[model samples]
Target: MTLILWTALGYLLGSIPFGVAITRVLGLGDLRQIGSGNIGATNVLRTGNKPAAFATLLLDSGKGAIAVLLARHFGGETAAMLAGGAAFLGHCFPVWLGFRGGKGVATFLGTLIALHWPLGLIACGVWLLSAVISRISSLSALLAAALSPVFAWAIGRADLVLVSLFMAVLIFARHRANIARLLDGSEPRIGRGKP
Candidate 1:
């Protein structure tokens, strides 16, 4: 029952589309029609609204952080990790947004940070490094998520490894398009204002 509750809470929290909300509120029209039409920060940036993009990123990350923190308070470490992972999945597959959602990058960062501070730091470093080197959001996210589990393993975070694994796999699945673009040398750059 507790697990179910945490998962549901996380999902609902994740479903709160910051990009959609902010865009509509700011009279930017539906964010879905702009850029890559994604509900993530990167796409929101394509609208030439830095504040909106930051708000989306911060809110998305905040939801994951809050979910995991709540689970920790209500249950334990394991439950916290589970809730965090659920939030990531929800962000990647929001029901309110036609079951299609963001690429789960920012939210995953939040989850990892909440689960383990040092691990989160490592994940962030890796993510930034990957993005800088590859210049592709999809590739950076894929590498970061993939490395998250390994970071957990290195830090002796046994409980978080499972969630990291799922997150890594799920992100890869969600970024199939990006992966294809990556392979074909047509992947878009991060600050290029989306596809």
Candidate 2:
């Protein structure tokens, strides 16, 4: 019951579409109508509002971090992991968005930071390196997500490895279209706007 409650709370909190709300507030109109139709920072960047995209990224990540932190504080590591997983799920399939939401990369990173800062930092490094090398946002995200489980295990966070793997799987699933585009060398690079 405690796990269920914490996970529910996490989902509810995570489901808040900061990207959509921020763009709307900024008078950018419905965020879903533009770009890839995704309510994520990358999609928001298509509006050519760097500040808005940055804000959306921070808030999206923050919500996941907050969910994990609260669950850990009240329920301990196991609950924290559960909450983090649920939070990631919420971001990927937000109810308010008719089960369509972001790709979960930002939320995954946020959960990693809350679960284990060292692992989070390592993941960020991987993301940055990949982004710099490939200039492809989806590729960078995929590489980082793929490496998180290994980092968690290396850091003696066995409990988090499964969660990391689960998040990685979801991230990959969400990027299926991007994966196809990548294979065809037709995917849009970061800062090039939507593909």
Candidate 3:
């Protein structure tokens, strides 16, 4: 029951839709009507509002981190992992948005960082390097997420491997369209706006 409550809390936090709120508050119009129509920082950037995009990124990441931290404080590592995974689910399938939401990249990294900072940093580095090489956001995110479980194992965090693998699977599932585009060479590069 306590774990259930923590998971609920995590989901609620992750479903806040910071991108929509920030864009609407700044009079930038509805986030859903712009770019890829994704409620993530990458889509937020399509509005040409760097500050709003940055804010959305920070808040989106913070929600995942906070969920993990809070659960860990109250219920130990298992709860923390469950809560973090719940948060990622919420981000990807937010109930408030008719179950449609972001791809979970930022939230994934945030949850990873909260669970284990070194692993998170390494994942982030992988993402950065991939992005620089491919200039493709989805590909970079996929690469980072796919490698996280391996990184966790290599770093001696066996307990975290399953959670990392779970998140990676979900991330890949959510980015199905992007994957299709990637395969066909039609995916847009970073800062090139929506595909």
Candidate 4:
């Protein structure tokens, strides 16, 4: 019963779709009409509204962090892990979005931060380094997601490894199209220098 409640809470919170909501509130048309038609921070960036994009990024990450923290406070470590995983799943397949949602990279990082701050920082570093080196958003996300589980395990956070691994797999799966573009040297970079 507790697990179910935590999962439901996590999913509901994760389904907020801040990107779409923020864009609309700011007078931007349907976010789905934007680049890649994705409801993630990266897509929000294409709207030429940096403020909206930053807000989306923070809120998207906050949902996952809030779920883990709430579960940990109300339940226990195990509950926190369940909630974190649920949050990631919700981001990937939000019911509010017809089970179509953004990749779980931001939420995944957020969960990691809640579960283990050190690992989260390391993952962010990996993301930053990858982005600086490659300038490709998808590639940076992929590298960060790929490294998260390993960092968790190395830090002796065995309890977090499974959830992180699941999140990583989902992130990779969600980036399938981006992966294809990357392989063919056609993935879009982090910015257009204008929008």
* Top lDDT model: 3
- CA RMSD, predictions in order: 1.3, 0.9, 0.9, 1.7
Q: Model 3 residue 158 lDDT?
A: 99
> Cα lDDT for residue 1, model 2?
97
Q: Score candidate 3 by TM-score against the native.
A: 0.97
Best-to-worst order by TM-score is: 2, 3, 4, 1
Please provide, for model 1 over 9-33, each residue's C-alpha lDDT reduced to its tens digit, 9 standing for 90 to 100: 8888877788889999999889888
Candidate 2 accuracy as TM-score: 0.97
> TM-score for all predictions?
0.95, 0.97, 0.97, 0.97
The models' CA-based lDDT, in order, is 0.86, 0.91, 0.93, 0.88
Backbone clash pairs in model 1 (N, Cα, C under 3 Å; residues 3+ apart or in different chains), count: 0
- Per-residue accuracy of model 2 over 20-101 as CA lDDT, tens digit each: 9999999998999988888989989989999999999999998889999999999998899989999999998899999888
Q: Give the clashing residue pairs of candidate 3, or none.
A: none
Clash number for every model? 0, 0, 0, 0
- Give stretches of model 3 more than 4 Å off: none
Where is model 2 poorest over a 10-residue stretch in terms of lDDT?
Answer: 186-195
Q: How would you encode candidate 3's per-residue C-alpha lDDT over 118-189 as one tens digit per residue?
A: 999999999999999999989999999999999999999999999999999999998999999999999999
